[model samples]
Target: MIKSMDEFTLTINGKQIETKETIGVINPATEEIVGHAPVASKNDLDLAVKAARSAFPKWASRSFEERSELILQFANAISENQKELASLLTLEQGKPLSFAEREINMAVYWLKESANHRLSTEVLEESETTYIEKHYTPLGVVGAIVPWNFPVLLAMFKIPLALLSGNTLIVKPSPYTPLTTLKIGEIASTIFPDGVYNTLSGDDALGPMITGHPGIDKVSFTGSTATGKKIMESAAKNLKRVTLELGGNDAAIILPDVSIDEVIQPIFWGMFLNSGQVCINAKRIFVHHDIYDKFVDKLIEYAKTVRVGNGLEPASQLGPVQNLVQYKKVKNLIKEAKQNGLKFAFEGEAPRSGYFIPVTIVDNPPENARVVTEEAFGPIVPLLKYQSYEEVIERANRSQYGLGGSIWGKDIELAKSIADKLETGTVWINEIGALSPTIPFGGHKQSGYGIEGSVEGLKEYTNTKIIRINKR
Candidate 1:
C-alpha cells in the first residue's frame, strides 16, 4: 500500500483549504491506498464559485494576446513537470506509464494549440454609414466536470480553452482521478491570479452544487450518457449554458480491399488503448463477410502478445481497469454476452486476478448483445459480419450514439463514401480513434451536444457580442 499524508485538499479562492474528512485514493492494480484527498463540503464549493466570479471581470477584460501568453506558459509548465504528472496519473488511474505520458503530452499539445489559434478581429466595411463588427467575449464562471479516464487530457480540453477565451473556471475533477487536477490547480496558482482557475475535488454530491449554483454561468461535462442527462436537468434550473461529451459506442468497418494483417495492430491499439476506457474507442467491429473470419483469427493472434500488469511496469501494455466499479461493469457485460449465446475468444490464458480482464473478442455476436450494444468500456471487441457497403453503413448508424466511426478500404473514394453515411462527429478512413489538436472533437445525439478542441472549442467558453458606434 502506498499511503501518504492526506494534506492535499480543495483549492478554493487561490488557497488550499484543509479539511477534516479525507477520501482514500486507491491504486486498482494492487488495491493499495495510494494517498488521500480532502472531500470538499458545500461551503468549499461556494468559495470556489465566489472566487471565479470575482476573477471574471479582470480576466475577461484582458487582451486575447495576454490570455494566449498565459496558456503558452501553462503548457510549458506542463511539459517541464511531465514526469511528475504522468506518475500521479498512473498511480491514481492505473493506466500504463507510457500511456499516461502520452496523455500528458497530448494535454500539452492541446493547451499550446488552443492558445495559438488565431483570434482575428475583422471589420465589416459596408458603405461607411452602417458598419458592424462581431467580437467574442468570455462567459463568466465556467463550471467544468471531467471524467477519470484521461483525466488530465480531458481537464486540459476545458481549462486551457476556457482560460484562453477569457473565462474564469470552477473545475470539479473526478473523485477517482482528482490528484493530477489538484496538482494542476497548484501549478496554476503560480501562473494565474486568484479565482482565474480553481479546483474542488469531491464525490458526485459536489457536482450538483457546482452545476446548479446560480453563480455559475456555464457548465461543461464529460462522462456517461445517464450522468450527462442529470447534468442537463440540473443546469436547466439556471438555464445555464452547457456542453456535454457523453458515452460513445463507436464502430469500425473493414472493407474487402484492406489486408487483415495491415490493419489489425492499429485496430488493436485503438480499441485497447487506456484499456479501452476511451469515449471514442472502437467498441464494435464490422468486417466485410469475405474477410471476417481471417480478420478475427489475425486479431486473436496479435492480441496474445499483449502484456497486462501494473502501470509502472515497462513491459505492461494493458493495465487494470481504473476502478472496481468499471471492473465489475466489464465483467458483467462479458458474462451477460456469453449467457446470450456469444462465444468469447482470447489470445492468452486469462489472468488469475478478476480485475485483469483479458483482450476478449466475441465472435459472431448478436446485434442486440450487451457486448455489441452497450459501451463495454473495457478491452472487449465484438466482431460482426456485413455483406455489403450499404449494410455496414446502415448497421453503424443504428445506434443512438453518433460519436465516432472508421472505415477501412483500399479505395479512398469508397471509404469516404461510406464514412459520410456513418452518423458520427468524427469518421476515419482506414483508421480508428485518430484525433489531433488541430481538428474539432465532439459527438452528436445521445453522445452529447457541443464541440471541443481547436478554435471552435475555445468559442464554447466565449460569448459573441455585437457593439455598434454612430458616426456623426
Candidate 2:
C-alpha cells in the first residue's frame, strides 16, 4: 500500500484537499502504479489562487529578518524529513538512490543559504540633504511551474527564493511527477502561513490556470522551449512578470591537448548525468580532429561500464528515462540517427521492459541531423568532429538554445578564451553545467528569458520601487 502521501492527497491552505477525480502516480522503473494523487479541478485552482492573494499581505509585510526565519524554519523542516523526501524523490524521479540523496542535500543547502542571502539596496544618490533609495519589494503570488527531471531541487530553487523575497507561491508540478511535489506542499503547510505555499496537482489545465490567473504577479518556469513560449503568451494576458529556464542543446567541446583519462569522467557525467535528461547536459560533443577517433574509442569503452537499472538498487549507476513519452522520443531519435548513417561509439544494452535506455554515443552525425540538432534529453549523445578550434566555436554558438556549454583542455587559459566565445548563459572551462546558488543561472537566445539562482533570481520575485527625496 502506498501510504506516504495520505494516499496522494493535495495540500492547500494547510489542509489535505482533494477532488472527485484523481491521478495515478507511476514508478517508471517497474511501470507500476505507485499511488494516486488528487486531480485538482478548476474550482480548486481558483480557491488556491484566492488564498495566495489573501495571504500575500501578511507574508509580504513581514520584515526581511522575519521572512528569513520562516525560510530557515522551512529548511529545517525539510532537513528533518530528508530521508523521507529523498526516498519519495527516488521513487517518483527515477534518479538513483544516492543521487536523490545528494539532490536532497543540495536542496537543504540552497534553502539554508537563501535564507541568509540578503538583497542589497541600490543607492543611486545620497547626500546630507537628499537621498535616493532603490530596492525590491514583494510580488503578490508567484506561480512556479516545475519540470519532472529534478522536481525537488527546482521547486526548492523557486520556493525558498520566492518566499525569502516575501512572495507567496502557488506551485504546479509536472503531472508526470507530482507526488514528490505534493509532499513538498505538505511539508510547507506545516511551516508557512496558510495559503503561503500551495500545490495544485492536475493535468493540462493546471498550467494555464496558474499562468493566466490575474492573482499571479510573476511566473517562474523550467521546461521545454515550446511550452515556455506558450507560457509567455499566457502570462502576457495579465502582463505578469515571467522568468523562464527552458530547453537547452548544450555543447561541450574537447580540445586537442586534453588527456582522455582526465576529461572522460567529467565529460561522461556532463552528458549522461540524470540519463541526459538534464536541461544543461552536454547534448552535443564537438571534438578536435586530433583526438576525435581516440576520444570516441575511449568514451565508448567508458560508456559500457555505466550500470543502468531501478533507482532503488544501489548498484544502479543510471536510472530509467522517467516516463513513456520521453522514452519513445529517445527511441525514435535513436532509430532516426541509425538510419541517417550515424554510428555508435558505445553500444550498451537495456532490458526490454521499463523506460531504461543504455548510454548511446552517435559518432559524427551531420549538424543538421535530428539527433545532432534536437535535444534528445536522453542517454543518447552525438559526438561531432571539428577540424579547427575556431570552427567548433562557431558551431557551438550556432544554436537556438544556449543554456550552457563547456570547453575541455589542459590549458585552462586557452579553454577560458574558447569558452568566452560561446553564446550560452554559462560556460565551463573544464566542467559542464556546474551550478551554484551563489551565482545566477539563465540562458541566452531562445533558451528563454530571465535568471535563476543568486540574488538576481531573488529580485525576479519582486518589483523595484524607486524613491527620491530632497530637502525643501
Candidate 3:
C-alpha cells in the first residue's frame, strides 16, 4: 500500500527510480506547494521504454483469462485506496472532493468493465476450398500520455485495454497533476511483473521522448490538439500506431419545447462541471429564441446556488482551475469577450485568492467571438440564440471542432433529427457529458481521431492479422 507523501518517486521496471531534478506540484485552491515529484530525464524515459519492451513478450503470452483476472485485481486495489487518492487528486487537480471521488470510482468501474471485454478471433470464411480467420495481436510497448483533467480515469481505461490486449505500457501523466497517477504506479509495481507496467514523470521533454522512442510501438495520448499534432508527427518517424484524443469546443442546443424548470439544472452543470475544464463540456450553447430569455434567467438562478472554494471544504461546489497556464488562458478569453462588447448574462463571484475563475455566462456572443469560437477550458460559457433548428445546426457544424454536441427538447424525434445533422463524434439528446465504458467515444475533424472506448477502442492497442488455409 502506498501512503500519502509530500515527495514522490517514479516507477520504472517495478523499482522506484529517482531523478536528479524535482518539480513541485501546486495546490490550485491555495497556490501552495502540495508535493514534490521527481523529474525524469531522456535517459530515464529510454530506460522505462526499454523495460516495457523487455516485458512485452512474456506479458503478451499470458492467457486472456489470466490478464482479465489481474486487471480486476488492479481495479480492486484502486477501490481500496479510493479515499486517499481522491484527497491527493483534489490537492493537485483542484476539483471538488465529490468529483474527485467520482473520478476514482469511475476509474475502478472502467477497469472492471474493460476486463470483461475479449479480443476473440473472428472466422472470416469456412469452405472446402479455403478457410480464413482474423486475429488481434498485441502491439509491443505502448506509450500512454494522459492529460491533467481526469488523469486517473483516463489512464485506468487505457491500462486494462492495452494490457488485456497483451501490450506492456508506460504512462506519462501531465506534469501538472502527476501525483495521484504516480501513486497508482506505486500500486501497480506490487501487482504486475517488472517492466510490464511503468510510470515516468517529468516536464514537457518526457512526452516527445516517449512518442519518438524506437522501442515504443504505439502512442495513446489525450491532450490539446496542438500537442496531439506534435505527438502524431513524432510517432510518425517510427510509423508507430497513435491514438490521439484532443481538444473539444462542444456545443449544446436547447429547443423551445424544454421545460425551463426541469432542464435548467442539468444544462447548468453540463456547462460548468469540472469548472468547464472537461474536453467534452458544453462550451457553446444555442437556445431557441422563443424560450431563450426564460432559460437564461433560470440558468442564472441555478448558477447562483453553486459555491466555489477549496476542494477540501465540504461546502464547495466548484474548485479552482487545474493549473496556472489554463487559468490565464480562460481569464484572457473572458476579457477578450468583454472587450468585444459582449453582454454578460450572469457573471458569478470568486474569492480574492487562488486560481479561481467565477462561473460566467456570455449572452448571445457572435459566432466568431473568442468565447464561442475557441475552446475555453474554464467556467466561461457563451449562450447563443437560434431562431430555427436548421440555423442552429448550421452554426454548430461550422466550427473546426467536431468532438461532441447535444440537443435539449421535449420532442424526442425532433431533437433526434437535429442531432443527426450536427457534425460531431457524439450527440446526446437532453443529456450532456455522459460517458459509458461500453460506448465508443472519439472525435471528428480537427478535434482529432481514434476511439477510446468499447470494442473499437480495445482494438486500437492491437494489430490485425489474417490466417488463410488452402486445400488442394
Candidate 4:
C-alpha cells in the first residue's frame, strides 16, 4: 500500500517503488508544496516497460468478459475514493473542487463504458473454395502519457481502452499534476495483475524515454501540438503506434439568429471551464455583427459572476493556472494583447498571491493578432466580429489547430450546415464540448490524430490481422 497519498510513489510491476530523487508538487492556488512525487529516471522507465512487456501476453490471453470485470472493479474502486481523488486533483491541478469532482465522475463513467465494448473478428468472405477473416489483436504494451489539463480524465481515456483491448500499460502522468494519478495507480496495484498496469511520475526526461522505448509497442499521448510533433517523430524511430490528442484553438461561431440569452451561459462556461485551460475550450469566438455587441455585453455580465479563488474553497468557481510554466505562458499572452492594443471587453479581478489570471476578454481583435490566432489555454479569449456567414466560417476555420468547434444559432438547419463546414473533428450544434463515452473524439490537422473513444478508439490499441484459408 502507498505510505501516504501526499508523498506518492511510482507503481511498477504492482509495487510502490520509491525513487531516490523526488519533485515537489505545488498547489497552483497558493504556490505551496502540496506533496512530493517520485522523479523517475530512464532506468525506472525501462523497468516499467520491461514489466509491461512481460505481462502483455498473459493479460491479452484473458477473456474479454474477465477483462471487463476487472476494469469494472477498477472503476468502482475509483468511485469509492472519488472525494479524496477529486480533492487531490483540485489541489494539484488547480481546477475548482466542483469541476474536479465532475472530472472524476466522468472518468469513472468512461472506464465503465469502455469496458462494455468488445472486439471481434470480421468475416470478410466465406465460400466452398475459399475463406477469409479479419481479426483485431492486442498491440503488446502501450505507453500512455497523460497531460496536466484533465489528467485523470485523459488517463482514463487511455487506461480502460488499452486494458480492455488486451494491452498492458505504463502510464506517465504529467509531472505538474501527478498526485491523483499516482493515487489511482495505488488503487490499480491492488486490482490488476503484476506488471499489467503501472504508472511512473517524472519531469521532462520520462516523455522521450517512453516514446523512444523499443519495448513499448504503442504510445498514446495528450498535450500540446508542438509536443505532439516531437512525440510523433520519436515514436517513428521504432515505428511504434501513436495516438496524439494535441492542442486546439477551437472556435465557437454564433450566427445572427442566435438567442443572446440562450447562448450566453454555454459560451461563457465553454470559454472559462478550468479557467479556459481546456484543450477544446472556445479559444476563439466569431460573432455576427448583428448580435456581436449584445453577445459581448451579456458574456461580460456573466463572466463577472464567476468567483475565482483557491480550488479547495467552497465558493471558488474557477482556480489558478495549473503550474508556473503555464501560468507565465498565459500571462505573456495577456500582456502581448495589451501591448498590441487589443480592445478589452471584460477583465475580472484575481487574488495577488497565486498563479492567477483574471477572466480577460479581448474585443474584436484583428484576425492576425496573437490573441485571435493562438491557443490561449487560459481565461483570456477573443471575440471577433464578422459581417457575413461566409466571412465568419472562413475565419473560424482559419487556425492550424482544429480539435473541436461549435455552431450556435436558433435555426437548427443553419447550425447543422455551419457545423458540417467546420474543420474540426468534432463540431457541436448549439452546444460546446459535449463529449460522450460512446462517441469517438479526435482532431483534424495540427490538433493531433487517432480516435480516443468508441470502438474506433478502442481499436487504436490493437493491430489488425487477416486470416485466409483454402478448401480443397
Q: Which candidate is the best by lDDT?
A: 4
Candidates 2 and 3, the one with greater TM-score: 3
For model 3, residues 1-472, the per-residue Cα lDDT tens digits are 8855556889999998888898999999999999888899988888888889889889999988999998889889989999999999999999999999999999999999999888899999999999999999999999889999899998975888999999999998999999999999999998889999999888988888888889999999888999989988998887999988889998899988898898888888899998888899998999999988988889998899999989999999999999999999998888888788999999898876899999999999888888888998999999999997778889999888999998888999999999888889999988998988789999999887799888899999999999999964
Count of clashing residue pairs in every prediction = 0, 0, 0, 0
In the predicted model 2, the residue pairs found to clash are none
Clashing pairs in 4: none
* Model 4: number of backbone collisions: 0
Q: Candidate 1's residue-wise lDDT over 307-417, tens digit each?
A: 888888898888888888999999898788767777876635444653577778888787978788899898788889999888888889989899999887799998988
What lDDT score is found at residue 326 in candidate 3? Answer: 93
Cα error, candidate 4, residue 383 (Å)? 0.6
Q: What Cα-based lDDT does every candidate model obtain?
A: 0.84, 0.87, 0.90, 0.91
**What is the lDDT for 242 in model 4?**
96
**Ranked by lDDT, top first:** 4, 3, 2, 1
TM-score of each: 0.96, 0.97, 0.99, 0.99
Model 4 Cα RMSD, 1 decimal = 1.0
Per-residue C-alpha lDDT of model 2 across residues 256-364, encoded as one tens digit per residue: 9998888898899999999999999999999999898899888877888889989999889999999999999999998887887787777687766789999888879
RMSD to the true structure for each prediction, in A, is 2.3, 1.7, 0.9, 1.0
**Candidate 4 local lDDT, 1-472, one digit each (tens):** 3346667889999999999999999999999999999999889988988999899889999999999999999999999999899999999999989999999999999999999999998999999988999999999999999999899999988999999999999999999999999999999999999999999999899899889989999999999999999999999998999999999999888888888897799889899998899998999988888888889889988888989999988999999988899889989988888998888988998889999999999999889998888888888999988898778788888889889998888899988887888899999888889887689999999998899999999999999999999986
